[model samples]
Target: MPEYGPLHGETVIFTGTLKSLEVFDLVRQYGGVPVSIPLIQVNEVEEPTDEKRMKTCSDFDWLIFTSQNAVKAFQSKMERFAISVNEIPCKIAAVGTRTAAALEKIGFTVEFIPTVFSADVFVKQFKPTDGELNVLFLKGSLAGSIIREELPFQVVEWTVYETGAKRDSINSLVDLLKSRRDCSVLFASPSAVRVFSEDAVPSVGWSGYTIGAIGHVTERALLEAGATVDVKPEIYTLKELVETLSNRKDEFR
Candidate 1:
């Protein structure tokens, strides 16, 4: 057998979508088993009915995306409507580095990013259009109201996706975790933490497990849920969280 890593015999419950297999591979590389039980699911709407028309058809001046899901949803919607990239008339702004990179991956250039990667900072840095301020916001159903409340401009929202509880194989997952000596959960978003905590029954030995939240928002949710968070990554990404857990093996142990 090969040598075991510091995380040998450990297990990690991943609560995010499998957008990529990076999280699973990282956990295994660190000698921890990865158990995926995504607490939230995002489904892109096949069409934008409320927004009614393509953003290029409106007098939209700016397009904003907060998460990679929002960016991917926008791209998927645009493609559905046959709206080509060259046809987009407005500039794009993204909240986080990953969001910006996602936009670039779809051949859309990001024009603005705040100094910090939070909705508050992005809202404060947002510049409004001169007249009517027709800005387009690509949003998820469960998205926070900060963008709507803080916008100085008139916002046209295209809710391209809906995010909700995604629970399956919960009993089996609980059994799997119960067998592990050092089990930790990884939470990428606040909603993920909320859904998992609220749905988890009291019979489950939640107290025995450790939690890892990706950012302050998720950390707040974990705190509110009364879950003992073992690790929280400063960078607020899945890869960073896995790497941080690998480095600080004692924390989870």
Candidate 2:
């Protein structure tokens, strides 16, 4: 048996609105079972804010998409505005493979991508020649200020989508927590942390199970909610999270 065999036999649950196929594979590779039960449902808020929509591809020199949801929302609004695929004038940038893939599916090739998928690295690699270089950031409403704070040029912020906690998901997660013998829960974003706390934290006491957070923001949310954060990777990306967890398997044991 493996030294971390006990850790592998444990169950890990992932909850959020985002997809978890990649995280699931990583969990399986490390001899852990992964369960996904979304705590929220993601949906576009309304028609893109008119000012923000007009400023996105037309006025900006570079358009930055941090998530696939942002890319999809932007594309949907582009269709509504009657903007042809080739009519986009700004250079396209994506923070992750998923966001890049979303742009690629819409016939836009990514002009720049950072080695690390976090906002810090994304802002680090961003270079603009002119002070007038406008940057349009397509992201969620709850995102932190990385591009806005770091960039020297003008930034147009747009909130394309918002996530809300779902009653069914909350009920399901509560039931799972009550029945499970030994399990770990992974939180990928602050919103997920908020949703978990709002729904399951009161009912599902956090005495026995382990809690893993993806980044500083999620870790802070977990801590503030009175949950013990057992695992937090240095790098914010999913790949780094898995690598960190796999390497630190002994700690869980």
By lDDT, who's the top model here? Answer: 1
lDDT of 1 at 195: 71
lDDT of each: 0.77, 0.76
TM-score per candidate, in order? 0.88, 0.81
- What lDDT does model 1 reach? 0.77
- Ten-residue stretch with the least lDDT total in model 2: 1-10
Error of model 1, residue 2, in angstroms: 6.0
Best by TM-score: 1
Model 1: which ten-residue window has the lowest total lDDT? 48-57
- In candidate 1, which residue ranges exceed 4 Å CA deviation? 47-52, 55-58, 127-133, 250-253
